[model samples]
Target: MKIVTIFVMMMHITGSLCAQVLQDIKLNAPDMERGLTIMKAFGKRASATSFSSKDLSLQDLSDLLWASAGVNRPENGKRTAPTAVNAQDIDVYVLMKSGAYLYDAKTHSLKGVIAGDNRKMVSERQTNFANAPVMLVMVSDISRFRGDDTEQKLIWAAMDAGIVSQNIGIFCAGTGMVTRPRASMDTEGLKKLLVLSGTQYPLLNNLVGYPNE
Candidate 1:
Protein backbone atom coordinates (compact mmCIF):
# COMPACT_ATOMS: atom_id res chain seq x y z
CA MET A 1 0.00 0.00 0.00
CA LYS A 2 2.81 2.39 0.90
CA ILE A 3 4.68 1.69 -2.31
CA VAL A 4 1.52 2.14 -4.34
CA THR A 5 0.79 5.44 -2.64
CA ILE A 6 4.31 6.66 -3.32
CA PHE A 7 4.01 5.65 -6.97
CA VAL A 8 0.80 7.62 -7.34
CA MET A 9 2.34 10.71 -5.76
CA MET A 10 5.32 10.51 -8.07
CA MET A 11 3.03 10.28 -11.04
CA HIS A 12 1.16 13.37 -9.90
CA ILE A 13 4.38 15.35 -9.59
CA THR A 14 5.73 14.27 -12.97
CA GLY A 15 2.48 15.18 -14.68
CA SER A 16 2.48 18.86 -13.66
CA LEU A 17 6.20 19.57 -13.59
CA CYS A 18 7.60 22.96 -14.69
CA ALA A 19 10.78 23.91 -16.51
CA GLN A 20 14.35 24.26 -15.11
CA VAL A 21 13.62 21.42 -12.75
CA LEU A 22 15.82 21.08 -9.71
CA GLN A 23 18.42 18.35 -9.64
CA ASP A 24 18.98 16.34 -6.51
CA ILE A 25 22.18 18.09 -5.49
CA LYS A 26 24.87 16.36 -3.49
CA LEU A 27 25.41 17.74 0.05
CA ASN A 28 29.14 18.29 0.39
CA ALA A 29 30.03 21.55 2.20
CA PRO A 30 33.00 20.72 4.36
CA ASP A 31 32.42 23.02 7.33
CA MET A 32 31.54 26.57 8.41
CA GLU A 33 34.81 28.33 7.72
CA ARG A 34 33.43 30.58 4.97
CA GLY A 35 30.10 30.65 6.72
CA LEU A 36 31.68 31.79 9.94
CA THR A 37 33.55 34.43 8.03
CA ILE A 38 30.32 35.63 6.47
CA MET A 39 28.79 35.81 9.91
CA LYS A 40 31.53 38.19 10.99
CA ALA A 41 32.06 40.24 7.84
CA PHE A 42 28.45 41.22 7.43
CA GLY A 43 27.80 41.46 11.15
CA LYS A 44 25.28 44.22 11.74
CA ARG A 45 25.47 45.82 8.32
CA ALA A 46 29.09 46.85 7.99
CA SER A 47 28.65 47.53 4.28
CA ALA A 48 26.57 46.68 1.27
CA THR A 49 27.71 45.83 -2.25
CA SER A 50 25.95 45.40 -5.59
CA PHE A 51 26.16 41.76 -6.63
CA SER A 52 25.33 41.56 -10.33
CA SER A 53 27.46 38.87 -11.97
CA LYS A 54 29.33 36.79 -9.44
CA ASP A 55 28.75 33.09 -9.99
CA LEU A 56 28.57 30.49 -7.29
CA SER A 57 29.68 26.93 -7.80
CA LEU A 58 27.79 23.97 -6.40
CA GLN A 59 30.00 23.80 -3.33
CA ASP A 60 29.63 27.54 -2.71
CA LEU A 61 25.87 27.25 -2.91
CA SER A 62 25.94 24.33 -0.52
CA ASP A 63 28.04 26.24 1.96
CA LEU A 64 25.91 29.39 1.83
CA LEU A 65 22.65 27.53 2.29
CA TRP A 66 24.04 25.68 5.29
CA ALA A 67 25.25 28.85 6.92
CA SER A 68 22.02 30.69 6.19
CA ALA A 69 20.00 28.44 8.44
CA GLY A 70 21.54 24.95 8.51
CA VAL A 71 22.35 23.17 11.74
CA ASN A 72 25.92 23.50 12.88
CA ARG A 73 26.12 20.95 15.71
CA PRO A 74 24.33 17.71 16.28
CA GLU A 75 23.09 16.06 19.49
CA ASN A 76 20.24 18.59 19.78
CA GLY A 77 17.77 19.67 17.12
CA LYS A 78 18.66 23.31 17.82
CA ARG A 79 19.35 25.32 14.66
CA THR A 80 21.00 28.60 13.78
CA ALA A 81 17.80 30.39 14.74
CA PRO A 82 16.39 30.93 18.21
CA THR A 83 12.81 29.80 18.47
CA ALA A 84 10.20 31.08 20.86
CA VAL A 85 9.63 28.14 23.21
CA ASN A 86 11.67 26.27 20.64
CA ALA A 87 8.57 26.36 18.52
CA GLN A 88 10.79 26.61 15.43
CA ASP A 89 7.78 28.06 13.70
CA ILE A 90 9.69 29.44 10.76
CA ASP A 91 10.57 27.58 7.57
CA VAL A 92 13.26 28.95 5.24
CA TYR A 93 12.44 28.30 1.61
CA VAL A 94 15.28 28.93 -0.84
CA LEU A 95 14.45 30.11 -4.35
CA MET A 96 17.00 29.89 -7.14
CA LYS A 97 17.35 29.41 -10.88
CA SER A 98 17.40 25.63 -10.57
CA GLY A 99 14.28 25.55 -8.39
CA ALA A 100 13.02 25.98 -4.88
CA TYR A 101 14.06 23.96 -1.83
CA LEU A 102 13.49 23.71 1.87
CA TYR A 103 16.75 24.01 3.77
CA ASP A 104 17.40 20.89 5.85
CA ALA A 105 19.67 22.09 8.65
CA LYS A 106 20.38 18.78 10.32
CA THR A 107 21.67 17.39 7.07
CA HIS A 108 23.16 20.74 6.02
CA SER A 109 21.62 20.59 2.53
CA LEU A 110 18.51 21.19 0.47
CA LYS A 111 15.42 19.09 -0.17
CA GLY A 112 13.49 19.83 -3.36
CA VAL A 113 10.23 21.63 -2.91
CA ILE A 114 9.30 22.00 -6.60
CA ALA A 115 10.83 22.12 -10.06
CA GLY A 116 11.49 25.34 -12.02
CA ASP A 117 12.90 28.87 -11.60
CA ASN A 118 10.26 30.18 -9.26
CA ARG A 119 12.41 33.02 -7.97
CA LYS A 120 10.66 35.67 -10.02
CA MET A 121 7.37 34.84 -8.36
CA VAL A 122 8.99 35.22 -4.96
CA SER A 123 10.36 38.67 -5.72
CA GLU A 124 10.11 41.44 -8.35
CA ARG A 125 13.82 42.28 -8.16
CA GLN A 126 15.72 41.59 -11.34
CA THR A 127 16.69 39.28 -14.17
CA ASN A 128 17.10 35.60 -13.28
CA PHE A 129 17.69 36.38 -9.63
CA ALA A 130 20.69 38.29 -10.86
CA ASN A 131 23.41 39.56 -8.51
CA ALA A 132 21.70 37.59 -5.80
CA PRO A 133 22.56 33.94 -6.11
CA VAL A 134 20.25 33.02 -3.24
CA MET A 135 16.88 34.29 -2.18
CA LEU A 136 15.45 33.09 1.17
CA VAL A 137 11.80 33.30 2.03
CA MET A 138 10.91 33.08 5.70
CA VAL A 139 7.56 31.52 6.47
CA SER A 140 5.79 31.18 9.77
CA ASP A 141 3.57 28.27 10.78
CA ILE A 142 1.02 29.33 13.39
CA SER A 143 0.62 25.79 14.67
CA ARG A 144 4.20 25.80 15.93
CA PHE A 145 3.32 28.17 18.75
CA ARG A 146 1.15 27.43 21.75
CA GLY A 147 -0.93 30.23 23.11
CA ASP A 148 -4.55 31.13 23.44
CA ASP A 149 -3.86 34.70 22.42
CA THR A 150 -3.61 34.61 18.63
CA GLU A 151 -1.76 37.87 18.06
CA GLN A 152 0.87 37.21 20.72
CA LYS A 153 1.80 33.84 19.32
CA LEU A 154 2.20 35.11 15.77
CA ILE A 155 4.23 38.05 17.01
CA TRP A 156 6.61 35.70 18.77
CA ALA A 157 7.12 33.62 15.66
CA ALA A 158 7.75 36.70 13.57
CA MET A 159 10.28 38.08 15.99
CA ASP A 160 12.08 34.77 16.28
CA ALA A 161 12.26 34.43 12.52
CA GLY A 162 13.67 37.92 12.31
CA ILE A 163 16.58 36.86 14.45
CA VAL A 164 17.31 34.00 12.10
CA SER A 165 16.95 36.30 9.13
CA GLN A 166 19.51 38.75 10.51
CA ASN A 167 21.98 35.94 10.96
CA ILE A 168 21.76 35.41 7.22
CA GLY A 169 22.62 39.06 6.75
CA ILE A 170 25.72 38.69 8.85
CA PHE A 171 26.71 35.57 6.97
CA CYS A 172 26.36 37.38 3.69
CA ALA A 173 28.47 40.30 4.84
CA GLY A 174 31.18 37.94 6.03
CA THR A 175 31.31 36.30 2.64
CA GLY A 176 31.47 39.48 0.58
CA MET A 177 27.89 38.91 -0.46
CA VAL A 178 24.98 41.35 -0.50
CA THR A 179 21.48 40.78 0.83
CA ARG A 180 18.29 42.70 1.53
CA PRO A 181 15.39 41.38 3.62
CA ARG A 182 11.97 42.66 2.74
CA ALA A 183 8.40 41.92 3.64
CA SER A 184 7.23 43.79 0.56
CA MET A 185 6.87 40.66 -1.53
CA ASP A 186 4.15 39.65 -3.94
CA THR A 187 2.29 37.46 -1.46
CA GLU A 188 -0.35 36.17 -3.83
CA GLY A 189 2.17 35.39 -6.52
CA LEU A 190 4.47 33.55 -4.12
CA LYS A 191 1.62 31.44 -2.81
CA LYS A 192 0.98 30.08 -6.26
CA LEU A 193 4.63 29.51 -7.05
CA LEU A 194 5.47 27.79 -3.77
CA VAL A 195 2.25 25.74 -3.89
CA LEU A 196 1.48 26.73 -0.31
CA SER A 197 -0.99 24.63 1.61
CA GLY A 198 -3.72 25.64 4.00
CA THR A 199 -1.37 26.37 6.91
CA GLN A 200 1.57 27.93 5.09
CA TYR A 201 2.10 31.60 4.24
CA PRO A 202 5.00 33.68 3.04
CA LEU A 203 6.25 36.16 5.67
CA LEU A 204 9.56 37.72 4.66
CA ASN A 205 11.93 37.57 1.70
CA ASN A 206 15.69 38.08 1.57
CA LEU A 207 17.77 38.63 -1.53
CA VAL A 208 21.37 37.30 -1.37
CA GLY A 209 23.90 37.62 -4.15
CA TYR A 210 27.43 38.71 -5.02
CA PRO A 211 27.93 42.45 -5.27
CA ASN A 212 28.51 43.88 -8.70
CA GLU A 213 30.30 47.00 -7.54
Candidate 2:
Protein backbone atom coordinates (compact mmCIF):
# COMPACT_ATOMS: atom_id res chain seq x y z
CA MET A 1 0.00 0.00 0.00
CA LYS A 2 2.81 2.41 0.87
CA ILE A 3 4.54 1.75 -2.47
CA VAL A 4 1.36 2.42 -4.40
CA THR A 5 0.77 5.64 -2.49
CA ILE A 6 4.34 6.84 -3.23
CA PHE A 7 3.90 6.00 -6.92
CA VAL A 8 0.68 8.01 -7.12
CA MET A 9 2.37 10.97 -5.41
CA MET A 10 5.23 10.86 -7.91
CA MET A 11 2.78 10.91 -10.82
CA HIS A 12 0.96 13.87 -9.33
CA ILE A 13 4.19 15.80 -8.92
CA THR A 14 5.23 15.08 -12.50
CA GLY A 15 1.85 16.20 -13.79
CA SER A 16 2.02 19.46 -11.90
CA LEU A 17 5.47 20.31 -13.26
CA CYS A 18 4.43 19.42 -16.78
CA ALA A 19 1.40 21.72 -16.54
CA GLN A 20 3.25 24.77 -15.24
CA VAL A 21 2.78 27.69 -17.62
CA LEU A 22 5.79 29.96 -18.00
CA GLN A 23 4.82 33.48 -17.07
CA ASP A 24 5.43 36.57 -19.20
CA ILE A 25 9.04 37.67 -19.33
CA LYS A 26 10.16 41.28 -19.02
CA LEU A 27 12.34 42.38 -21.95
CA ASN A 28 15.24 44.76 -22.03
CA ALA A 29 14.00 47.63 -24.14
CA PRO A 30 15.74 47.83 -27.53
CA ASP A 31 17.64 50.89 -28.75
CA MET A 32 15.66 51.88 -31.83
CA GLU A 33 18.14 54.42 -33.15
CA ARG A 34 20.94 51.88 -33.03
CA GLY A 35 18.71 49.32 -34.74
CA LEU A 36 17.87 51.72 -37.56
CA THR A 37 21.54 52.50 -38.08
CA ILE A 38 22.33 48.80 -38.31
CA MET A 39 19.49 48.25 -40.79
CA LYS A 40 20.87 50.91 -43.08
CA ALA A 41 24.41 49.58 -42.71
CA PHE A 42 23.65 46.05 -43.90
CA GLY A 43 24.27 46.53 -47.62
CA LYS A 44 22.98 43.03 -48.36
CA ARG A 45 21.71 40.04 -46.43
CA ALA A 46 23.95 37.09 -45.65
CA SER A 47 23.50 33.57 -44.28
CA ALA A 48 25.52 32.77 -41.18
CA THR A 49 26.86 29.23 -41.02
CA SER A 50 28.40 28.78 -37.56
CA PHE A 51 26.69 29.31 -34.17
CA SER A 52 27.46 28.97 -30.48
CA SER A 53 25.88 26.15 -28.47
CA LYS A 54 24.82 28.40 -25.63
CA ASP A 55 21.18 28.28 -24.63
CA LEU A 56 19.40 31.61 -24.90
CA SER A 57 18.21 33.09 -21.59
CA LEU A 58 14.66 34.17 -20.96
CA GLN A 59 15.73 37.79 -21.22
CA ASP A 60 17.41 37.17 -24.56
CA LEU A 61 14.29 35.49 -25.94
CA SER A 62 12.13 38.32 -24.65
CA ASP A 63 14.31 40.98 -26.26
CA LEU A 64 14.33 39.19 -29.61
CA LEU A 65 10.57 38.79 -29.63
CA TRP A 66 10.02 42.36 -28.59
CA ALA A 67 12.29 43.63 -31.33
CA SER A 68 10.60 41.41 -33.87
CA ALA A 69 6.96 42.26 -33.18
CA GLY A 70 6.24 43.48 -29.68
CA VAL A 71 3.85 46.33 -28.99
CA ASN A 72 5.60 49.61 -29.65
CA ARG A 73 2.59 51.69 -28.67
CA PRO A 74 0.69 50.17 -25.76
CA GLU A 75 -1.79 53.04 -25.95
CA ASN A 76 -3.27 51.55 -29.12
CA GLY A 77 -1.63 48.08 -29.44
CA LYS A 78 0.51 49.05 -32.39
CA ARG A 79 3.32 46.56 -33.08
CA THR A 80 6.92 47.03 -34.18
CA ALA A 81 6.01 45.41 -37.48
CA PRO A 82 3.05 46.53 -39.57
CA THR A 83 0.26 44.21 -40.65
CA ALA A 84 -2.00 44.57 -43.62
CA VAL A 85 -4.89 46.88 -42.72
CA ASN A 86 -3.58 46.65 -39.16
CA ALA A 87 -5.26 43.28 -38.75
CA GLN A 88 -2.26 42.39 -36.56
CA ASP A 89 -2.91 38.70 -37.03
CA ILE A 90 0.48 37.09 -37.58
CA ASP A 91 1.66 34.69 -34.86
CA VAL A 92 5.35 34.12 -34.08
CA TYR A 93 5.64 30.51 -32.99
CA VAL A 94 8.98 30.02 -31.27
CA LEU A 95 10.92 26.75 -31.56
CA MET A 96 13.44 26.43 -28.78
CA LYS A 97 15.46 23.87 -26.81
CA SER A 98 12.93 23.60 -23.98
CA GLY A 99 9.75 23.45 -26.04
CA ALA A 100 7.47 25.31 -28.41
CA TYR A 101 5.76 28.61 -27.55
CA LEU A 102 3.63 31.24 -29.23
CA TYR A 103 4.96 34.74 -28.59
CA ASP A 104 2.22 37.03 -27.27
CA ALA A 105 3.39 40.52 -28.20
CA LYS A 106 0.63 42.31 -26.32
CA THR A 107 1.43 40.60 -23.02
CA HIS A 108 5.16 40.10 -23.72
CA SER A 109 4.73 36.43 -22.84
CA LEU A 110 5.37 33.04 -24.30
CA LYS A 111 2.23 30.97 -24.36
CA GLY A 112 3.14 27.30 -24.08
CA VAL A 113 2.07 25.30 -27.07
CA ILE A 114 3.79 21.97 -26.35
CA ALA A 115 6.31 20.72 -23.81
CA GLY A 116 9.40 19.21 -25.46
CA ASP A 117 12.56 20.27 -27.29
CA ASN A 118 11.43 20.09 -30.90
CA ARG A 119 14.01 22.50 -32.26
CA LYS A 120 15.43 20.10 -34.79
CA MET A 121 12.09 20.00 -36.56
CA VAL A 122 12.70 23.41 -38.06
CA SER A 123 16.03 22.57 -39.71
CA GLU A 124 16.50 21.97 -43.41
CA ARG A 125 19.23 20.40 -45.60
CA GLN A 126 20.53 23.80 -46.62
CA THR A 127 21.43 24.57 -43.02
CA ASN A 128 21.23 22.77 -39.69
CA PHE A 129 18.98 25.38 -38.13
CA ALA A 130 18.61 23.16 -35.09
CA ASN A 131 22.11 24.23 -34.08
CA ALA A 132 20.99 27.84 -33.88
CA PRO A 133 19.89 29.09 -30.48
CA VAL A 134 16.46 30.23 -31.69
CA MET A 135 14.07 30.05 -34.60
CA LEU A 136 10.85 31.99 -35.13
CA VAL A 137 8.23 30.41 -37.35
CA MET A 138 5.99 33.10 -38.80
CA VAL A 139 2.43 31.92 -39.26
CA SER A 140 -0.44 33.92 -40.71
CA ASP A 141 -4.12 33.15 -40.34
CA ILE A 142 -5.75 33.59 -43.72
CA SER A 143 -9.12 34.14 -42.08
CA ARG A 144 -7.73 37.28 -40.47
CA PHE A 145 -7.77 39.02 -43.84
CA ARG A 146 -10.53 41.58 -44.39
CA GLY A 147 -11.62 39.78 -47.54
CA ASP A 148 -11.90 36.29 -49.02
CA ASP A 149 -9.37 36.84 -51.82
CA THR A 150 -6.91 33.92 -51.56
CA GLU A 151 -4.03 35.48 -53.49
CA GLN A 152 -4.35 38.70 -51.57
CA LYS A 153 -4.15 36.78 -48.30
CA LEU A 154 -0.88 35.13 -49.31
CA ILE A 155 0.55 38.40 -50.58
CA TRP A 156 -0.17 40.27 -47.36
CA ALA A 157 1.00 37.47 -45.13
CA ALA A 158 4.32 37.22 -46.93
CA MET A 159 4.82 40.98 -46.97
CA ASP A 160 4.02 41.50 -43.30
CA ALA A 161 6.15 38.60 -42.15
CA GLY A 162 8.98 39.87 -44.35
CA ILE A 163 9.00 43.06 -42.30
CA VAL A 164 9.34 41.14 -39.03
CA SER A 165 12.01 38.93 -40.53
CA GLN A 166 14.03 41.99 -41.51
CA ASN A 167 13.59 43.35 -38.00
CA ILE A 168 15.14 40.18 -36.63
CA GLY A 169 17.93 40.23 -39.20
CA ILE A 170 18.77 43.82 -38.41
CA PHE A 171 18.76 43.08 -34.71
CA CYS A 172 21.17 40.21 -35.24
CA ALA A 173 23.38 42.31 -37.45
CA GLY A 174 23.68 44.99 -34.79
CA THR A 175 24.45 42.55 -31.98
CA GLY A 176 27.01 40.47 -33.92
CA MET A 177 24.61 37.59 -33.70
CA VAL A 178 24.34 35.29 -36.70
CA THR A 179 21.08 34.64 -38.56
CA ARG A 180 19.41 33.14 -41.61
CA PRO A 181 15.88 33.31 -42.99
CA ARG A 182 14.32 30.51 -44.99
CA ALA A 183 11.01 30.27 -46.82
CA SER A 184 11.46 26.61 -47.71
CA MET A 185 10.60 24.67 -44.59
CA ASP A 186 8.69 21.56 -43.67
CA THR A 187 5.47 23.52 -43.45
CA GLU A 188 3.15 20.52 -43.71
CA GLY A 189 4.90 18.72 -40.87
CA LEU A 190 4.90 21.81 -38.68
CA LYS A 191 1.21 22.39 -39.37
CA LYS A 192 0.39 18.87 -38.25
CA LEU A 193 2.59 19.08 -35.16
CA LEU A 194 1.34 22.51 -34.21
CA VAL A 195 -2.25 21.54 -34.99
CA LEU A 196 -2.74 24.80 -36.82
CA SER A 197 -6.16 25.77 -38.14
CA GLY A 198 -6.77 25.12 -41.84
CA THR A 199 -6.58 28.83 -42.57
CA GLN A 200 -3.21 29.22 -40.82
CA TYR A 201 -0.14 29.20 -43.07
CA PRO A 202 3.47 29.01 -41.95
CA LEU A 203 5.10 31.72 -44.08
CA LEU A 204 8.74 32.02 -43.02
CA ASN A 205 11.47 30.75 -40.70
CA ASN A 206 14.01 33.03 -39.00
CA LEU A 207 17.08 31.60 -37.26
CA VAL A 208 19.19 33.58 -34.78
CA GLY A 209 22.24 32.78 -32.63
CA TYR A 210 25.60 33.98 -31.38
CA PRO A 211 28.45 33.59 -33.86
CA ASN A 212 30.73 30.65 -33.11
CA GLU A 213 33.53 33.00 -32.12
Superposed model 1: Cα runs more than 4 Å off: 1-21, 35-49, 125-131
Instruction: Specify the highest-lDDT model's number.
Output: 2
Per-prediction CA RMSD (Å): 6.3, 3.0
Worst 10 residues of 2 by lDDT: 32-41
Model 2, residue 206: what's the lDDT? Answer: 88
Off by over 4 Å in 2: 1-36, 39-45
Q: List the pairs of residues colliding in candidate 2.
A: none
Candidate with top TM-score is: 2
Residues 1-213 of candidate 1: C-alpha lDDT, one tens digit per residue: 999999999988887664435666667864545544433564446434455655566776776666666676667777777788888777888887777888777666777878766666655754444446677898877777776777887788679768877877776666666777777677788777777775566778788777776
Residues 142-196, candidate 2, lDDT per residue (tens digit)?
Answer: 7888878989888998998889898788777765666788887788888987889
